[model samples]
Target chain A: TAGITQAPTSQILAAGRSMTLRCTQDMRHNAMYWYRQDLGLGLRLIHYSNTAGTTGKGEVPDGYSVSRANTDDFPLTLASAVPSQTSVYFCASSVLLAGEQFFGPGTRLTVL
Target chain B: SQQGEEDPQALSIQEGENATMNCSYKTSINNLQWYRQNSGRGLVHLILIRSNEREKHSGRLRVTLDTSKKSSSLLITASRAADTASYFCATDQYSGGGADGLTFGKGTHLIIQP
Candidate 1:
């Protein structure tokens, strides 16, 4: 079913460049999330969508933005990427409140 | 900032040995989940224990939760090299429409030596 899929598996971007990490789920889940994992640090939420057309800020949302235009897709955008943004990003989806979450393969971004 | 904290940052054990990892959280939660991540890959959901439940098991894995103590433990029986991975605990709080997603712990790097 391709539970969840993320695009641009890996990318190398120059500082100040812009890029979007794409995430899609076919499970018709109502909740989707964006998280970044850094060395020594656990995954931190970047943004989340309760449902289509609604998004909320998470713990680390300063350099990132997200949009949930439909039930199947939630994309994260990085404007003017920085070296600090170099990390593996993951997207997840869940069926209901507090349900088990399924994660995508992840996108590795390296900013030089 | 990690909501859940896993103790013993890392662990190494031989095959057939039992491995245990602990996790502690600060606040109440609707449920807590365990995930395993292999090197350079996405996390795979292992198991989930609800606040109302105290213990759960899946195959060779057993999980125990003590709400009063605000802590949980994951035990793997008869470990194998394929079980080598980093294990993390994530909590899903009732607040925030369950949309807050999971607050993950630093994780325990488990190496099951063959």
Candidate 2:
């Protein structure tokens, strides 16, 4: 089974342009998350969804938004991309809130 | 803010040697987990230890957690080049029995020389 899959393995965008990173899990998980990994900042949570139709802001959620319309999919959107948003974004899913999360391959975004 | 910090930002050792990494967290946690990431790839869950458990072992990897000190250590015995990767410790902070996301450390970069 494809535990989780992310679209556009990599992308390059101009500043001020909008983009949406797609994440889908076949594990039928109840919890999904979006995280951005920087060089030395580690992985910071952008947003999370406990279940379908419920989304919550995380530690670093200022410039990002997420929607969990269903259990298998959670997408992160950047209304207007900025150079600071250039980082590796990861999508993960877990069976429960505190369970071991399975991550997708990851999507590398570059904002110029 | 990050909940945990890993000691020795980077480590290098020859194959057949044992490597150890340490992690310290700030707040109380329900569980702690270790994840490994190869270059340009996503992280893979290695192991998880609950607050109540002190030590756990799986294959060549051994993990020890000390709730009293809010610290943990991971040991890789007979390491190989294939084990070379960045290891991160994540903490599932206790939120009074509510949903909470795991906070991760910067991670330790391990290099195994052949």
Query: Quick one: best DockQ, which candidate?
Result: 2
Candidate 2 C-alpha error for residue A45, in Å: 0.5
Candidate 1 chain B weakest ten by summed lDDT: B92-101
Segments in model 2 whose C-alpha atoms lie over 4 Å from true places: none
Q: lDDT, candidate 1, residue B56?
A: 100
Residue B11 local lDDT, model 1 = 99
lDDT of 2 by residue, A8-107 (tens): 8999999999999999999989999999999999999889888899888778998899999999999999999999999999999998876899999999
Q: Top model by lDDT, which number?
A: 2
TM-scores for all candidates: the values are 0.97, 0.98
Runs of candidate 1 with Cα error greater than 4 angstroms are: B94-99
Which pairs of residues clash in candidate 2, taking residues 3 or more apart in a chain or in different chains? none
iRMSD values, candidates in order: 1.4, 0.8
